[model samples]
Target: MNNHSMTRRLLIGLMTSITLIWLIATVMGLSVMEEEYDETFDSSLQETAERLVPLVVDDLFRKEEIVAPQQLQAARPDEEGEYLTYQVRDKTGKVLIHSHDAPPTPFPAPLQGGFWSDDTHRYYTATGVSNTIFVQVADAFANRREALSETGLALFLPIFALLPLGLALSWVITRRALAPVDDLGLEIEAKDSGNMELLKTDALPLELLPIAGSVNVLLQRLRNALEAEREFTANSAHELRTPIAGALAQTQLLINELGQGPGKRRAGQIETSLVKLNHLAEKLLQLSRAQAGVGVSEKPVDLIPVLRVLIDEFHHSGQDEDRLICRCAPNARLHGHYNADAFAIALRNLIENALIHGDPDAPVEVSLKADGSISVVNGGPVYTPDELAKLTGRFQRGHTTATGSGLGLSIATRFLEQMHATLTLASPASGRDDGFEAVVRFPHQD
Candidate 1:
């Protein structure tokens, strides 16, 4: 899904640790190998020098002219043994007898008693009995470096060969190890309100079994709770609506019969309270149904006609009907893939909100734009951006004294959510000093 996935991170960390280990081991092994090779090879050179000294001394005692010994000369003209060189010199550093490849002049440094090295050669020097004769054995720097290089390549070649295989193995192992999690996700995703069966954990790894059990328990509890709530709400709303409608009907009849006095005024007020209660009950029922995702329709619905009917009802409420304006672009017909009942509920609540909260004298504008968006504009108090952001919260009203349940905008927002639309609230509708506007933007290309 991203570069930050756990599997990728694990592989990266594992590879990094492996590379570091190889590097550290290589360095330490090279250090040890250099010392051991130097000691072993240098021992062989010292043995050659030891054997040559007796022959050179014997020749010196015989008073013979300097002559190369059979063993001291190069075995062949151009073979690797030529990398070794030897010299015999007097105390003042005058060269006497020497190997074929040795320099006529003495070695670069004055003779020291033991092993020493300069830029080009590693030298081992020996002093004669009277300190008058000096013997030096030398090896080439390039020859030593070639030997070390071969040793290193031999030791590290296997690591380089195995790196690709290690990376591929890690990738496969990590994916297979995480397969149980992927299976759990697919199983949970397929579940719904009607399908709340426990997740099967029998084949899962031990680490995942507990998590699956916890999730199954949570799902069962939620299923039981929702079932209880739906049954109670369905029963309560029905039981309450019958008595409320009967009381209102009886109150209205009593208001007509009571005629003029204190009794008539009290009956009228009771009728108003009953009507408000009935409206609240209906709103609660609508809210519950919307939340439970009921009444969702697959059929496409016409939006404009339902809006027109809602606007007409404004006049029947004895308000100034002219304040409400409905504007639609000519030759444009609006349609959406949503339930007609849902769209009607959303539109009616928006219209009711504009009428109740807006200034009575200023016009409340309802327009369907060319972009297939519907906007409800009304003259209301100027609210800050923070207040507008919270307009759709349940039971949140513009004013506490307003004769409203405050669920209108919340319900409208919920219904629009089901239709893949949004309710955006803005204060001071464009170019105006003070007003609130609620815009419902339809889904693009729908």
Candidate 2:
């Protein structure tokens, strides 16, 4: 029951891939920048130590009694601070001369060349005057970390700005790319029994051309099958009408000729069978037409006259006029585009079903509502909802001994579907305790 859109999936997938790639690239960039920063700072630390060795050696050798260690003052003693600190140590691990910011103690580095580091600072030791004078420069770990942190931020900030823009561009591109698929799906969805036209493949992409071709082939085959079915049903019904009428007439004549005997009774049974068969054939023809979607029309039609004509015909056919109550609201109207003949067929079936299956003593009430809905109510035994649901199926009869072909509701439902209308059946009619009601509702009016 869960459905997902292809466009959304594609967009998310594309954006995720782009973001991951950017993150990976940024991580790699940060790694490389860290290494280069360490190398450049270390080279500068070694250079500063190497260049200061001779100066410290020269200053110490000229001193008149170098017994006490000396603290070298900076040229700008009032300046803020120094990032690099240095100490000049003697061969006996004593700090002989130290920079203004250097700690008073001798550094932990061994008196040798090259670099060394502890938890706090990176140290590079350079020696002069036969390795007796050792010049050590120390760089703080925090300084190196701050430089890498700034570089990493520069690498990461652009991803945030570019990610949203990338997602927006990807959304537009994905939807445009999938527009053809959406169009094809809609066109396929519009197909029904009433419209079986071939799919148009000329403008379709090459990837979708085969799907259109297959659907067209299937539509053609279905169209052929339905046309054959309609032809057979109509032809069979048309062919049998004359013979069935003739047979009924001959049986009636036989019943008249044989007066009140076993033979007369048998002939009467034959006439009844012929009548039922003829009615079934007519129903089959109507069902075939309904399936062919004969209820659709281009223009709205006035069907008030059609309803009256059908009622009059039913009255003339031996139904007492008093038993059929008809009422039309003054504001009631149906101006929807539909075939009048189809509307008549549907309403006639509802009325006929009510009259036949209803209690003989109770009158059937037919009414048109102000909103262009028609209702047929008749006194009858109440039916369960499950039982009422099956009434619209072909050859499904109700809990009655009434003589009917049982295709009335099925045919009416088929035609109403073609007209975009609905047929609703309810037991225990609106204001009654035990009755049946059939209502026809149109989708639109005027």
- Which candidate tops TM-score? 2
Give stretches of model 2 more than 4 Å off: 1-8, 51-82, 99-101, 157-172
lDDT (Cα, tens digit) per residue for candidate 1, span 66-168: 5433234645756646767888877888777788788776788576667888898888877775878778888887887888999889878877888889999
lDDT for each residue of candidate 2 in 1-446, tens digit (9 for 90 to 100): 99998888898888888889988998898888889999999999999998998888888878878754677876456686678999998888899888888888999999998899999999999988898888999999999999888888887898899888988888888888888999999999988877788989988999999899999999999999988988899899989998999999998888888988888888989999999999998898898888788897898788777888888888888865678988989988877678999999999899989998998789999998888899999998999999999999999999789889999999999999888899999999998999999999998665
- List ranges where model 1 is wrong by over 4 Å: 1-12, 43-64, 67-82, 88-95, 99-136, 140-209, 299-320, 331-336
lDDT of predicted model 2: 0.89
TM-score of candidate 2 relative to the true fold: 0.88
Residue 108 lDDT, candidate 1, scale 0-100? 81
TM-score, one value per model: 0.72, 0.88
RMSD after CA superposition, every candidate: 6.4, 3.1
